[model samples]
Target: MMISHGFKSSKKDFSFGPWKVTTAKNHIMKSKDIERLTEDLNLRALPEMLFGDNILRIQHNDGFGIEFNAIDALKRINNSDDTLQVACAQQWQESRVVSEHTQEVVRPYDWTFTTDYRGTLIGEEMQMKVTETTERINLEKLRAREQIVFFDEVLLFEDELHDHGVSMISVKIRVMPTSFFTLLRFFLRVDGVLIRINDTRLYHESVPTSLFTDPNEIAQHLAFKLRLCEKLELPEQKQGAVNEDLK
Candidate 1:
């Protein structure tokens, strides 16, 4: 899934008429720390449930919003080298090119974008080894694997509305399944990197003002949704994942 953040502001036009309006645009990059934080998050474990934790925390900027699958796992890699393969899945969006040579751009998938901060080394060959920098490593692609933290449901608070807040959104993912490859006891390799994930729904959406009367209404609506979100459960196969905590 992909998330984009933008700030809204009003524009005044007296000639046409007086109206309350807003516009949003992509925020530009200003800090090198964004890159570091993105890398840390890529290697960091995903919470059991989506929307859990400050998953989108930035060093200097306030997170405007995040768009993720309210439906299913965006992608899954099944191969001999589960360790290396899974790490790539978390870091990069997959693409296919006719040649590994220069001057050929693979057609990008519309359903997804590359969340991977690092470039892909799917077709390359490398020796695998453990390193202190990462709890688990995807040396086949020369990268690190992440551990899975507890899955949680994220709730957005809105105070300007009613007693019943609106449910902003709901998201979840299989965290333990992600961290399983990190166990040093198991080592594996991959001949190529494969990405097979697509969002069934739009990755990003705009909240409608008509959904609630005021900020309080939005808050109450979200409160109700959060409670319902808590009922969500990962499948039985996705339970009890364990990994070494990051130092």
Candidate 2:
């Protein structure tokens, strides 16, 4: 479960039960590639540490798969001028190079690069249908100290925002003898503004007995949800007051 890593492009592949998984890493895009990305994504600016070619993939023998990559995640960003905003986000961006973040009154896009991208689902047979289900991820099982057969972490993108704070999205996957778990997180910390975090978790057993009934048939038990957390960077004097209110 050794993963080869380097500053440039590197990829690792592993087979776990009926699933095939791979992680790819590459250098951030250069000026030429940046222009292409901006045009293709219709985004005025992107993260400084944008690993556009990095990717994580998991495929099942039954024609089902999921993938996480910088391109797909960035595409999910809001394109409109009137998207998620913050009080000082625009000003902070304007302080940087005018080419990167314009000084215009309103930016053309959400410079924050907030995204709702869960991993992409792919297959020729599975049709996505929305339905209600009571299933939830087993936190206890995930927390257990199981022997990890394979594990790897890859960064999709990251930005320092002129060193104002960190805004990054990274994906980590772990495969045990029993199941595989994947976590993708988008973390943002606008200095003196607020902290926002978004997470996507995927978990499935490598060998499910129920699927043995039909050798060629496979079903993915997925849990999808939008969970967000935000905390205002209030003054120290207000902290006690706010905490008292929760009482």
Candidate 3:
């Protein structure tokens, strides 16, 4: 399915974006491996994609991090600013990897709806209501509805393993619109799980870096946004009532 994947601003910030690495040379390495190196170097991997040539990894220390990539200085002189282009490719590739991982993680479950309108007047009218997500996902039901799977609600999810402690599962869900006309009334789960309802305005909101940085945060942010969107997008009657109440 074609999606209007959003890119973090930066024509030059190519290290991470939407394209998946369809094919890569053997020299390519997994992001986790690079992250391991970052830890060994006592670095924190921030979003920045450093190095022009080769794969770029972000690194940092003291609670700060930056991006790093393979350095082939020669590639720089040979009309190949390998550092920049490689960073761009890595950025694009990593985005694809994360996007795919998120998709894989969220594909199995159905987004349960909620009935609670208290979250907001808008939500009361537009969103499905449910209490716990687990209550909503009927695996067998999902399998049966596979024909309309694309229209099924989508969620973005991620998990992280700490050096010491149990692994963490992060997740977020969005209501996907059935068509372009429904874009204003529905939302789609994003890689970050920052659900964007209505392609009009709220979709453009910038969330905290933490949401994109961690899957859990993404999930939490998504839930909060969903609640908020529900409150904001009131039906015609509710909107009129709210206006009358204000007057």
Best by lDDT: 2
- What's the distance in Å from true for residue 69, model 2? 0.3
Q: Tell me model 3's lDDT, rounded to 2 decimals.
A: 0.24
Order of candidates by lDDT, top first? Answer: 2, 1, 3
Cα lDDT listed for each candidate: 0.25, 0.79, 0.24
Instruction: Please report the TM-score between candidate 1 and the true structure.
Output: 0.17
- What would the TM-score be for candidate 3 when compared with the true structure? 0.16
- Which regions of candidate 2 fall more than 4 Å away from where they truly are? 1-6, 82-87, 95-108, 124-132, 208-247
Question: Which should have the higher lDDT, number 1 or number 2?
Answer: 2
- Candidate 2 structure quality by residue, lDDT tens digits, 178-225: 789999999887778778899998888655566667645443333346
**Candidate 3, 244: how far from true, in Å?**
99
Taking every candidate in turn, the Cα RMSD to the unseen true structure, in Å, is 26.1, 17.1, 24.5
lDDT tens readout by residue for model 3, 1-247? 2323223222122111221111111222356765664455433231222222232111112222221123221111222122222222333334333254364321101121101111111122244333443323223422332222121111111112111111111111121121100011222233422333322111112244545878864663354333333356756754443435554
**What is the Å distance of residue 59 in model 2 from its true position?**
0.4
